[model samples]
Target: MQGENVSLHCRKKDANSSYTAKFYKNGISIGSSSSGNIMAPTVSKSDEGLYKCSIADAGESPESWLSVADLGFPQVLPNRQQFFQGEPITISCEGLNGRTGWRVMKKINGDIRICASTWETLIGSCNICNAYPSTDSGEYWCEHGEIQKSNSVNITVSGHPTVPYFKFYLVLYTGLSLLLVVILLILAGLFQHHKHQQTIRSHTKEMSLTPDDDTLYSKAIYTTLRPGETELKGHKKRAD
Candidate 1:
């Protein structure tokens, strides 16, 4: 609460005498007033501590403890702590109030930097466009000045895995297709050759069943003799 007007007045018993007032926090001078009134515009947590007001010429007042209530703590967004190389990541540093000393801190390579300058800032968040292994792996957190800090978020990066398995399967499927085609062609050729052999065998069997022309048309000679007489007569005859 930095804007709430809270006034601390130091009034002495004698109203006629006017004295200047000086405010102190933990024995440290913070502000001074002429009319013995310390006006705190906003009571921030930083303003929490012992408070005392002193009269200019008179002695200092008794110390009074000024305690400020706690609001929500600072935090990060996109809660996962792991990341991949060349991957886009988003981080945020949020405090109780808007931009009230809320800053994002990254510790990498033994160094630290506010994310707003190096990373893109949008809607109160930081965007690391492409995370890498070199300077993007380490702890991150939300900080409110140097006192209050959020829990650390660790990030890790790794290389992308190769995809040769896909190519290997592709080549394997192609070889198998070619082998199947060759096998089918060989089967077809063998079937055709077997059919040709059967046709040739059928023709040879038919030829063996048919008689030769010379054997089928050969002529025979016959001779006849008369009774009690010898006579020689020969004639070629075609027998049915």
Candidate 2:
């Protein structure tokens, strides 16, 4: 809410024992404090911009966007019906009455949420950080003392979809693994076949040695019988 005190913290970058921080808005120095927090006593439209903080010995922190909502009739800023997942949203309820007792109400996923009075400010606004598709997308409105004070705004939050290339990689991995297994099986079969061929060749060599031994015995018997026959023929010739 405008005129409400807001605090911006400067997170420390280094492991310094003590921190003296300077706050900046869009490259302009707002204030310097020892507590490392910049306090805006009364925030206005001019207070909104990219904000950061820097320490003496340390460097500057990353910039953050600061949005200030104008206190108009009770409503949601940028009254859009659709919002993406993880988007920031602001709900303001500054009606004809100026910041007396206003609360932000949201109905999401069949549950209703009522923001506390302490959560509201003179600006009658509060920030919803990182809206979720499942939890934060719903109808939101503002109320004051049991009376509906603002227009109901329905917000739709859509999450990022699954990437196509991710599934492609999954299929690719499956195919490669199957192909590798098949190739290994083929190599194993070829090795077994080679071992079987070697065993058959060894068995054939043993059979060939048996044939050679038979042939040598036949030749020896033939030579011995032929000499005996020659002796018998000589004896018959002598008897005659």
Candidate 3:
């Protein structure tokens, strides 16, 4: 009896209670008393397996066997489990059944992804932390070993597809091209206006000068600078 009280009873020839009692577990003597009975209370986890009780009477010993099973490993179920992408998951193992380790397996698009560990107790479920759709998506299961396995759980990754956003990008690119053409046309118009302004300013400044007026203007400036230079030039021309 693991984690329970135990009593060693020796069957008598006629329930006479006239014999002595002794107990042995796994072939080791545990307790014996002269009162013909033995009771062990609060049996710990270590006490398990087949036990035998013997009674010595009139120089004869008779023995009988008893089996005690303890509370051992935890339970592992398959029907109600799941897995998701980017989230690593683990499963609990039971019995001494060669856990060796546990493998978290998933059938992802007809492919398998597995992770293994040797533990009887699990701190978290098989669905790992912070699971996301694009990175971690697939059908999954918790595998114990080649000998023992659990049920399969499909991991459906839910998210929006990228195709619609790509189409939006194409639409934006076409709109940008139209905007660039309009900007170029506006710039060309502004350049034409500035060139026209420069031409008008040049034409207005040159209109103040005529061919005859240019000669009169030069004579006026020459007469003011020299008093008799023109008369001396005429005398020198006559002498020659």
Candidate 4:
């Protein structure tokens, strides 16, 4: 099982002087001991591998495989059932017993995916830096091997509708500009019409004040005969 102390021993056949026993993991040298015994304390998933030891003159021992098993269930931090899009979340498989090697798994869109294999894992926990409603929303759990798995958690991600500030302001400004131009054009047309009407009225008043040709001739004749003929005309009318 995981998180357990492990010890390997190697013995030489004949009684001899002290010799250093070297330990190898997966054919690579790990450490050496003077007592012909090597100890690995609190072994985890990373410690599980092929192990062998050898003395200086003696031959190497047969390789043995180490297997680590998960201790408990998995847990999700923040422990929320609902989340918004673009939020970060973490899924941890470090159970109550402090065991490791349990992988985070999810079923999304009817397909299963393993974290750190499909996505990214940070500090031994599966991290979704930017979540999405369509892709990241699903059932999540932890699995140690093919048979052992923790309880699943249903997660729902909600997407919020957003409008671009630049585009929205651009549309608003364009509409206002067009409306302002229309208003200015209407005002200019009305002003021109008012000015034309004022000019026409001024010209008509000047024509009415001026004398015509017939009126001017009658006035001149009356002014020429006025002084002498005025009293004579009255006397002639009385005699008739």
Candidate 5:
């Protein structure tokens, strides 16, 4: 853990195979070898997965669980956060190096560099690598072996607009349009209420001018008729 020199290994003679051997971590089936010994590159958090080696042949069940230890991914740092597509991007990964697996690594792209004699050898170099618009957009993670992945350095590249961009724009405009429609509906309701109040006032005045004989004993407009308002309207207006 302190140095990258930790080894959790086992041999394969327990099996019936004169064949090669393979190593695994947290159930990750890895490389094969003719020898019984399996060596670890560097261990890290991502390597925290279960580790065990399998023989090419069914020698014996002795190749069972070897190690279930926590593996840390090496830390990688990038020079800049942004880049242009098809351009170079560099990321510096930090970890103890030397034990054979010290190589610059790229996941999903499988670009493993071998100058990894020393951890510092790859630093300052910015881990220079190329970026393509389609492939490199996601998180770019690197590790020595299954060791800690270098601290992620994202190199987002600028690119030409695609059809998806247009779809996004259209979705945004549709959302705005719906919001505007709701606002207009609310304002129209308010305007209608205000106009109804003015109409009620007009109806009251028209009723006020009605003859006293027709008025009978009521000053309420419910006793008189107003244009556009019938008995049904009068009953509804009075209830309001």
Candidate 6:
């Protein structure tokens, strides 16, 4: 991996002999060591190249190739599947091996864009102060000089409120409306039943306070005729 320790040693026929050795990296002199060994601590991608060592009386050794790879993939901070409009976001492209110069890349609506070229960014991170759904939602990853790439992540930005909770609110509103309608229907039914009961009570009270048709006729006849007139009226009727 990238962050590893490397030690180079010069070999000789006499192992007990003390000789000064000089190290060269990519055809250039690096340093000289009296112990015939050189230690490179915490090697990175920049340290990868050809290396060799030369002795005072002996010729130069064969050149060896050193390769370095990334320790880990790039990551998005506060990882999530969704974001809101105008929300701030950060994407980190720094390698775990402490390597910088990694650029953040994104593919939105089939268009590819780089953070260093298209957006504002720092050394190995992309920061968006105000993210928009139309332009910010897509796949994001890291790239180094267009040669190496990291794992990608899918991001979705919502223009409205959180989708799941918004749906829940809609459902809640509908349920409350239905409940209110049911309550109103029950109240209307109760009012109608109460009015019918009151009408029935009023009819019963009138019947109890007033006399019947036959009783009213007898009272009217007695009030119109006298007692003697009643007897004469009966005798005249019999003679006729």
What lDDT, from 0 to 1, does candidate 5 have?
Answer: 0.53
Residues 1-240 of candidate 1 have per-residue lDDT tens digits of 333456888877777987778888899898888787877765666777888988766788899987765444325334555555877877766535555556677888888876657443422566788888777887777655455555567777656533454577788999999999999999999999999999999999999999897775564433545444443333333333
**Model 3 global lDDT (CA atoms, 0 to 1):** 0.53
lDDT of each: 0.69, 0.70, 0.53, 0.75, 0.53, 0.78
For each candidate in turn, the TM-score is 0.38, 0.32, 0.29, 0.35, 0.33, 0.40
Backbone collision count in every prediction?
2, 1, 6, 0, 35, 0
Candidate 5 lDDT over residue span 98-144, tens digit each: 33334444443454433234555553234446666555553554455
For 43-102, candidate 2 gives per-residue lDDT tens digits of: 667778999998877788889988866544445555755666777877777553454567
Q: What value does the lDDT take at residue 4 in candidate 4?
A: 64
lDDT for 234 in candidate 2 is: 23
lDDT of 4 at 135: 84
Q: Write one digit per residue (lDDT tens) for candidate 3, span 1-240.
A: 343467666555756556566767777888776565677664544555566667675432444444455333323232323333343433343332433454455566666655324344432244345556644466554444333345444554444435555688899999999999999999999999999999999998887664575576555232222443433322322222
Candidate 3: 10-residue stretch with minimal lDDT: 231-240
TM-score of model number 1: 0.38
Candidate 1 error regions (>4 Å): 1-17, 22-47, 56-63, 68-77, 82-88, 94-107, 110-123, 138-240
Best by TM-score: 6
Highest-lDDT candidate: 6
Candidate 4's residue-wise lDDT over 1-240, tens digit each?
Answer: 555678988778874778888999999998999999898876667788999999888888899998877555456666766777888888888753554667788899999988655543522578888889988899987766444466678887778633444577889999999999999999999999999999999999999999998886555222234444433322321222
Clashes of 1: 2
**Which structure is stronger by TM-score: 1 or 3?**
1
Which portions of model 2 show Cα errors greater than 4 Å?
13-16, 74-240
4 or 5: which has the higher TM-score?
4
Superposed model 5: Cα runs more than 4 Å off: 1-156, 214-240
TM-score of candidate 6 against the unseen true structure = 0.40
